[model samples]
Target: MFKPLKGLLVLDFSQFLSGPSAALRLADMGARVIKVERPDGGDLCRRLYISNLELDGDSTLFHSINRNKESVSTNLKDPADLQFVRKLIEKADVMIQNFRPGVMEKIGLSYVTVKEWNPLLVYGTITGYGQNGPWKNKPGQDLLVQSLSGLAWLNGDADQPPVPFGLAVADMMAGGHLVQGILACLVRRGITGQGGLVEVSLLESTLDFQFEVLTTHLNDGGKAPQRSSVNSAHAYLGAPYGIYETKDGFISLAMGSVTELGELLACGPLAAYADPASWFAERDEIKAHLRDHLKQGNTAHWLGILEPAGYWCSDVLTWQRLLEHEAFKELQMTQHVKRDNGAELITTRCPIRIDGEIYQSAIGSPKIGEHNDKIKQEFGGVVRE
Candidate 1:
């Protein structure tokens, strides 16, 4: 369906979330991605489990990120395997790896070495930190990066200890950044007829994710962010910008005039906050009043009053309620894919839409080295004895 990367080929040598996720995006755009893995055990993410769930003996996490891609197992340390991989590199339009700084160089597959084989190849790399930093060798785990980047300090109530995001935000952000860099380089390659190196680190990407608030801290006398003492959703935002409990459920509110919100909710104490500066200065008192007032009515009752008035508000929803809602159904965001062995998985389709057409595939992730025979036949590469 008008896939822009229809004829491109990608060799993904990365394991786990960050690098594999980048390859997944490329595959979604119609690139032919071949995962180059070790013959034994393959990607370590195959065993990285969440909730102890497994599909076809691989972690569901691995299956979710590796779909619509092929697999070719090779041991880079072996001369024969390394030679065959070099041949593949010579033919690939793009290559991705997430090994720590010097791992690829030691394996003789570094960008400096591979660029000589395929001049127009886009080489992408993801590291825990930038290559020259002291943190470069540190593990690039999601939580560690989150904690190190000060992102954890921005969540939860101010009284509570630092809270990390429930999801692997750092890995996902780095992956997305890598994709953006790779795509931009591809565009430039079309003009210059030369490939380029794209590098992203989990620490750097996570820092970029906090650019807005961090920018504020940098410019505003270097003052530390002051999170709301109650219902703190954002550290730098003012009153009425957090979720509140209702009689039956919860609702969230965004930025708006405090007096207008107080008038609408009939919370008279809020009239004192008519001056906008008081919203931030006395956010706890303002939010405490909102908290007590909102809990008196059901979530729907509060929504009914605020929605018609054009205030930015919503009823907080759980996954069950959201999936059942017609709005979610209209998006058609989920799809079913199956492995060759008939193992089926229900997962999300690509979020990107090209020319108003949603991209989807029925192919699931492959077994380690699943495409070895087919690849050897198609590419005519033989291992030197």
Candidate 2:
């Protein structure tokens, strides 16, 4: 339907989440993305799970993130294959890779080389840290970035040790930032008929997540936020912002003002702490009030009572429950698509909506070297022998 990136070509030299996921966004917008993998096991995610059941040729985890693209398996170390890749890069409008610092230069496929071939190409580089920094060469994982960025410190009960968040927040955030940078470069190219290199690092992205906390601490004379264990509110905004157990399940509630808190307490045992402004004035009193009321019922009872009271609340749903959630259904987030192998499985469509339609791309993740011959013929005007 009015796909803006219809004529754009993307060369995806990235693997794993940060880079590949960023390329996935371009693919979603209708760019012709060619995912380059190795002749061996391919993306490391191909061997991630210890699953004894092999449903597809590759691991499902690999398939999940590699959908809507052509897979070309070539050993970049080989001169002939490297030449083929260089030709592809010359024609690409965008090039994305997530190798460690200096790795791209060592391989001779750095942005500088691609820019020599196509000056208008948008080169995107994703890394664990910025191109050069004290920690640039140090290997980084999601967990390490979380801790380095102070997010881990913000998590968990005050008394317990800092716990890492389950979601890959650093990688995901970096991917989003990478996309924004790429789009900006694309826009600039449209105006000047020239492209520039765009870079995003997990460490840099993680720090952005702490903007609110960092800004507050900076203005507050460098006093870091304390890890509070009590049920009391931590921010200047008053209490009633946390997960509470009800009769059947758990629900999250966040009421910032005295009015919203009064509406929430009117539902269940929370009525005792109805006076939000005065209730949290003393830290000890706030904790005691929350413990006494929230423990009265389970999550379901709390949701049924508090949700209708105009309180911002939701059930803490497991994946299965979330799959069946009405909001997900209304949003059309998940879909079932058949792969080339004739098996159907669930996959996620792009989250963004362009106009009235939910963004759709080619269904199913590609098989290894799935379109190698076709791509070789199209790019070089002759298929590889």
Candidate 3:
């Protein structure tokens, strides 16, 4: 496959998720990402297990996020190792770091310092809040940032306490935002022949993530979002915008007309509230009615009716059902990745397609410092072998 970023090099100084995820995207697009790790333990994520699951002597979490990348161990505190890493940075096209503010500056790898050595390198930084805020020095964990940014309040029912997403959405979103900034910097560098620093915070990214609802909350008075008391799916959406229980399973409905949905489902009670304004105002009552009405049919039965009529609805699927479905099977999302140590794993590949072909790398993540020799020889850095 044609790789757009084939010749580009990225030196990833980030650990855990946020910064490493940005490097993962660059690697997915075919950049050579060399993870800079400490000689002692490398990324902390190696042992940061989300569950009891383990793969290749490290947590599956580490392998999944760091896949298709190289690793070069270095101790930034040591002068020799720091100079060695500086050599790699002098040649890298992009550098990503997620350490708390002033950590990189403590070392000599700050954007200002690095820009002196390499004028065209893009420096990307991810932080908890931002440079000067009181929260700047705090930990950038996903859940904490979500709570601080008011994202947790958007999920679950109205009466329930603030509920965070099941996944690390804050970190992932910050990674995406960093990638956008880095990509923009790269484009600017192409024209101006100068590098720039791109900074994003989990707080800012989480805020941007909910720009739609937050904007509504800001403009439509300082009122907090009121989630549906019954079958809540969206904080802003009205009735029929939630998961409904089926006889055997569950189905979700996106934004659509209440009257049209009522007419299609033959629910007389729902059809009575025909006013569009009531969709937002009477969301709970309508949702309660929908919850009762939908329970009479199975998921497939409702999909058969709703899908044919062009109402935005789908059967809520579990991971087991999703993997077994032909629609997912046709996408060919999964790949078998093997490491040089005879370790193998089944994981999803990059979601991007180029020239009608899905670009997937069979290369699994490296063992700590696995590529040290190869990268050191190729880059002609310090005498460290």
**TM-score of every prediction relative to native:** 0.99, 0.90, 0.97
Best by lDDT: 1
lDDT of 1 at 279: 92
Q: Tell me which residue pairs clash in candidate 3.
A: none
The 10-residue segment of model 1 with minimum total lDDT is 376-385
Candidate 3 C-alpha lDDT tens digits along 172-270: 999999999999999899899988999999999999999999999999889988888888888888777888898999999999999999999888898
Runs of candidate 1 with Cα error greater than 4 angstroms are 382-385
How much does candidate 1 score in TM-score? 0.99
In the range 284-356, model 1's lDDT, one tens digit per residue, is: 9999999999999999998999999999999899999999999999999999988999999999999999999
TM-score ranking, high to low: 1, 3, 2
**Candidate 2: stretches off by over 4 Å:** 50-54, 231-238, 258-284, 298-300, 381-385
lDDT of 2 by residue, 1-385 (tens): 9787889999888887888888888988889889888878677767665355444766666666778888888888877888898888889999999999888798888888778988999999888979887999876678889988888878765676777887888988998999999999999999999999999999999999878878888999888676545642344334556665655666666655544554556534345555646544543445445556666777777666667766677788998888888887898887775578776667788888877878875477777777888998888732232
Find the 10 residues in a row with the least total lDDT in model 2: 231-240
Clashing pairs in 1: none
Candidate 3: C-alpha lDDT = 0.89
